[model samples]
Target chain A: MSTPDPRLSINQGTLKYADLATALRATAEAGVQAIGLWREPVQEVGLATAARMLTDSGLRFSTHCRSGFFTMPEGPARRASIEDNRVAIEEAATLAAAGAAGSTAVLVIVAGGLPQGSRDLIGARERVRDAIGELAPDAAAAGVTLSIEPLHPMYASDRCVVSTLGQALDIAADFDPAVVGVTVDTFHIWWDPDVLASIERAGREGRIATYQVCDWKTPLPADVLLGRHYPGDGVIDFGPMTRAVMASGYDRDIEVELFNEDIWATAPLEAVRRTAAGFEVAVSPYLTE
Target chain B: MSTPDPRLSINQGTLKYADLATALRATAEAGVQAIGLWREPVQEVGLATAARMLTDSGLRFSTHCRSGFFTMPEGPARRASIEDNRVAIEEAATLAAAGAAGSTAVLVIVAGGLPQGSRDLIGARERVRDAIGELAPDAAAAGVTLSIEPLHPMYASDRCVVSTLGQALDIAADFDPAVVGVTVDTFHIWWDPDVLASIERAGREGRIATYQVCDWKTPLPADVLLGRHYPGDGVIDFGPMTRAVMASGYDRDIEVELFNEDIWATAPLEAVRRTAAGFEVAVSPYLTE
Candidate 1:
């Protein structure tokens, strides 16, 4: 068995605007251990076709990009969102069944901002919890572990309402450990004061399912939706973060996911290769034997 | 006594590069109840001169812009930073003595980010705590309650390492309640999952000293070194935040502090007046009689 570096996984978002086949080929060629596939790319090539390519290229599957949006106001829209996430879970299971290494774990959630005409953040959070509770069963039956990805608090309004690791674990603790888990992204949770403690708790509880890496830039623009730096380029100190994750006993893939205009503007192959190199350099100190 | 609208106050940053006296005069003319002053302006015109003008215009002093840099890594720089903050506390005391209405508090805290080659965030936080511990005595003696302003998590690196209300309060809890308190700026703490709970706790403990407001925009530009947006123009759900602060028993002035380049580029007076108006409209619902 080849002992590859688990810290070098590719998140499809790094090459989001690029063609799926082209992106996958580039990722495989770059020697990344795994890739986090998104729904859009799978839809583009058809799931079976994409599965065949991954099979051919020997690319391992990291957690899928997402599967949660259960916070919409009660109505058809909410039901539709839940159904869509179910489909994502099913897709993850399909990939697992098709010989991708590791369990079929779906990066289960992103926060949806406050509903129209609503001024209650607590109510919004309750809605998120209720929505996830509703989806946990279907996810479990499909042999998929729902990994709640707590986004940066900056996205608390429009994106994931799950803004901290502690909050995510609280939600996960409500469900069976095998059904619900937490995915720790360095960019999102690095600023959290209780992150290290929370990670330790999650690890002890066996809730950590995946790990992601990205950088936080300084003088961040007032608009954060599109602002993200490549790992090691920004201010987030990942040394302690890596040590904390490793301490969590989570020997999972560390996916590199950046959302910067500058990196996105470059050629897809070059971006993937550059990201792999950056990842190696950024996390080299924390890499365990 | 003319009862000023407590909800409408101006933070000097909204004016960007405008002259402080000019901005203050315009804010008073615009009928704003109070203004949050910065050190540069107070230094430029001399605190005594600035105080005299506020006395002449009958403008309320809501809070001083800042007085903390307690997070500097060991050495003369850290000591020098704390000394500078002490001067700011003295400046706030000067403003209070100059006939400005209400409790005058100076924001005291630390500079965040990797100090030189230090990659340990937890260690940085400890340094910040120690710095605060060191400054509390001087602040209390000056009759200036150093308000610890918890900046947004995005600023966890280079700005203020204190990124949440809970974290700020935790540090404050270690000091004499009369000496250290917490400042709640909507721009900074709105994204926190536990914001409401933390605010409530602050109120229960009488730690809620200063409050400010602004909005968060998505797709934010990479360069935020300039300024952000006015209260109502961005994506943040200010209504919930306003209610949360009010519910926390914070009956103090709610200052409007926007770091927006667009607003700053305009005449300083114009920016203050416009922001004051925006504050009235955006936060009117939560204002108590």
Candidate 2:
């Protein structure tokens, strides 16, 4: 009997230690068809060279890691975030320009957390929406889809005020689907009871830009950011979530994004292999089911 | 200018060190109108003695700590949870019978998290609903309202499957309001964007059983359970939540329940004073607004 394909892609953060070259090479060797790039590594590898590397390897750049810390207080901080996002949009365009024909390279945006010492989440969210809306035209022209990834509510106060898929869609709804959409990352959203319905709505609305997979684990790391686990290792049943997004007509690549300190400590290649296995166990069954 | 009233009712858990007698005496001396009792402390002091203490001090047993761990595997575990709930209902009955005229004693149910090694939140939630439904007859007969507390999603795995007021109300909708209702704890529900609306709906449906206040502090303790802070020490804006519950026509005593290590380490009497002050600063303004 043949083994099932995990249909996996690696988000660079899953192997935080790997350089762009090593990560790109590992993606091909790991037998995955795509890789999600973080701006820091992409820039370190030099954007032009990184884009060419992805093109040369015939690997899809599933998404440009991020660009949407638009929640900072107004003035230089806010202006800087918008300007940086513009550059990210341009980078996303270059990466998507070389992907598999119709694949839309997505720029996953983690709307910045609350400004230091500011507890005004409502105001922060409004600022994020305005910032994203302001960038939509540039995103449309560049052919890069801006995907709003709502962080978990635990991060609502200091990381991202957008804590729900419904909230992400609310902001995305105000822009063109070609320019703005929502990313569904299981680790961040699985706890949401309404997530399934939200994914369905995003699908029907043609706003499902990307689907990132990871499991939610407990005794969250002190950093909290390093707490994400590979699929099947935690309480989250990725089957329901994966199947829901799939049923929503999301046929695009699914990236197994882990931020665990343990996972990152391993060799990037070995981590990719384990991620593939985890994905097969946790998510592949649902694909067939 | 006079100091604002805390309108506080300390949950015995807030002072986990305090015995029932100490808790009762401190609550009365703290100038608060009520106290929420945990079963262990009540049983330790003997139910009859605890009831007499509450009566003697003119303190209302705003609620009985809990009864709902129905998610355990079937057989002894499940039966034990139901049986325990029955005893708690009886205890709640005894406590409520001694309350000041017009006060309805509540049984705050922290629906247990997922059963050992299980990951089915939906199933666990259903089991909770069924378990609560089974106890409704006893609750009705005893005149103790069963409050289904929707804990924060962070606790959905091991503490409570009901993670939102909407979910709690959904389960409660299947039962009698006089028997089953929902708890709105600021620490648990503050992260929910739609909590205000859910509170209003709970009020309209007459399912608002109790209101518990505490602030949500981050860098959660190793044991996330101890992460709660006194109001105003954290990011939760209690004014909107307090006013929403108030506007819902809920006139029952509000209980300030903290399960923080720092709070527990304080002298019970001193903790009461601090909790009172925190409530006045974080919640009193909303009462007037």
Candidate 3:
């Protein structure tokens, strides 16, 4: 794989609730090298129309935004989760046909705090694995790879319970390599003691399905449901992490994914522009020549 | 060692600006069984007066509040940290003489954040070990155990670098058992994946010097410096954690330590009473008959 171009890739969710065509046109004009299309946008425009627009614009397709919230242990919820991921795989496939440059890898997985009254972390993990396992064959058949994104441990309760890269890799290991992988978002795993090692391992295993960048702000409030910092503002040491990804021989587009209140409050184009600049400066020192 | 009664405790620095005599009088009347004193409080009333009050009131000293910001790596600054810890050890000895029950230990250390321009976590960890090694002998001689409190990783940048119970135990293992041990604070370490294992290990190794409790709230603002949640109001899975501590053969008082704007706004007695009530209710499910 070639070293990921550091230009810019807009995660569609950043402009959530905005008109898809307008957002796409603005993102492309802002000099973004690629765009991470989401399900809602594709659904709204009709997959065919969305695919044709991407083809006409000639923008590189980075990985799809997501597909996985496999936390419910059993019954209707687990079946519903599998069906949703299958739809996400189809969305990725549709985007791929529309002229996305990369493979149709649907980012799979969501995790959060355990169900109330549940104290069994290992058991909850098993539930995640089982849910993903059930969806793997379908994803592979649809020509899509499931990219499990491990959220920050703080979100282990209500969001994505998969809190570490290692844990994600463990779940991936249970499936055929072609069917499962991971999305490395800096915001989630930046504080991990084993982040560098895990990044390298992800590269070595060829499981680095995505590389997302963001910063970690200190004095983060006890309630962090939507309070992330922009890339340059927080204290996460991203230098070694970038180097580890590079050394692992995984060269891919670095996606700037910020979930900050300040950015969300601004115009979508403004957030995109600021994010692109932050990514360049923050990762400049560690970028491979 | 006998389990110290949890009732006889005085919150150090409760009267941050008040004279030590006044604080001690309030502590005595509150019917607190012991006092968790701070160095500055003693200085304000003069060691002679503060010592007399504790002796007069028959208050036992549970433990001193602190002594470690061991993250400054090198030269005079690092040496100063060691000397300051020594002073704290001396002060702990004085409190012990003033009717403090059992041996008095300085809350050994707080880990400092990433040094300027360096993201070398391994190197920072080494500095912590060195600081502890330098302070151990003086603390042991003063009859003060250096209780290494593993702070929350949120404080991993500017405050405490030792962010997990396991990390504290590892640092303690490098020293004489008599001089070093681990203090487990829920506020600081409740989020750790390895907390239960570490606590069990601490108990097996007889290295549990303290156990404190607090809650973690959500919708946390980006600035964590001002974000602390009162006990029973946040996402910490304390019930399971408390049960794990008890299972580890730790039969000790679970100190209720909270630092939050809401609590600080209330009268200290009210804060104490509410905290006690929260503790009883939250941990009741996990208590062994």
Best by lDDT: 2
Interface RMSD of each: 3.3, 1.8, 3.8
Q: CA lDDT, every prediction?
A: 0.76, 0.83, 0.70
Residue A138 local lDDT, model 3: 84
Candidate 2: regions farther than 4 A off: A1-6, A99-103, B1-6
Residue-level lDDT tens digits of model 1 in B187-254? 78776778878888888888878877877665455565443677777656677667777877777777
Q: Give the Å shift of residue B214 in candidate 1.
A: 2.9
Instruction: Write candidate 2's Cα lDDT for B165-211 as tens digits.
Output: 99899999998898899999988887777888999999999998999
Name the regions of candidate 3 deviating beyond 4 angstroms: A1-8, A14-18, A73-79, A116-123, A219-233, A265-273, B1-32, B75-79, B103-108, B115-122, B221-233, B284-289
In angstroms, what RMSD does candidate 3 have relative to the true structure? 4.1
In candidate 2, what are the lDDT values of residues A1-289, reduced to their tens digit?
Answer: 1232635678899989998888888877877778888999989878898888888877877899888888876799788889999999999989887665544679999998767766566778789888997899999888889999988877777778888898899989988887899999988888777888998899888999999888876767777778899888998887777888889878788887888889989988788888888888888888777
How badly does each model clash, as a count of residue pairs? 13, 1, 37
* Global local distance difference test of model 1: 0.76
Q: Is the docking of candidate 2 incorrect, acceptable, medium or high quality?
A: acceptable
Choose the strongest candidate by DockQ. 1
RMSD to true structure for each model, in Å:
3.2, 2.0, 4.1
Error of 1 at B62 (Å): 2.1
**How high is the lDDT of residue A17 in model 1?**
83
Weakest 10 consecutive residues of candidate 1 chain B by summed lDDT:
B218-227
Error of 3 at A135 (Å): 2.5
lDDT of 3: 0.70
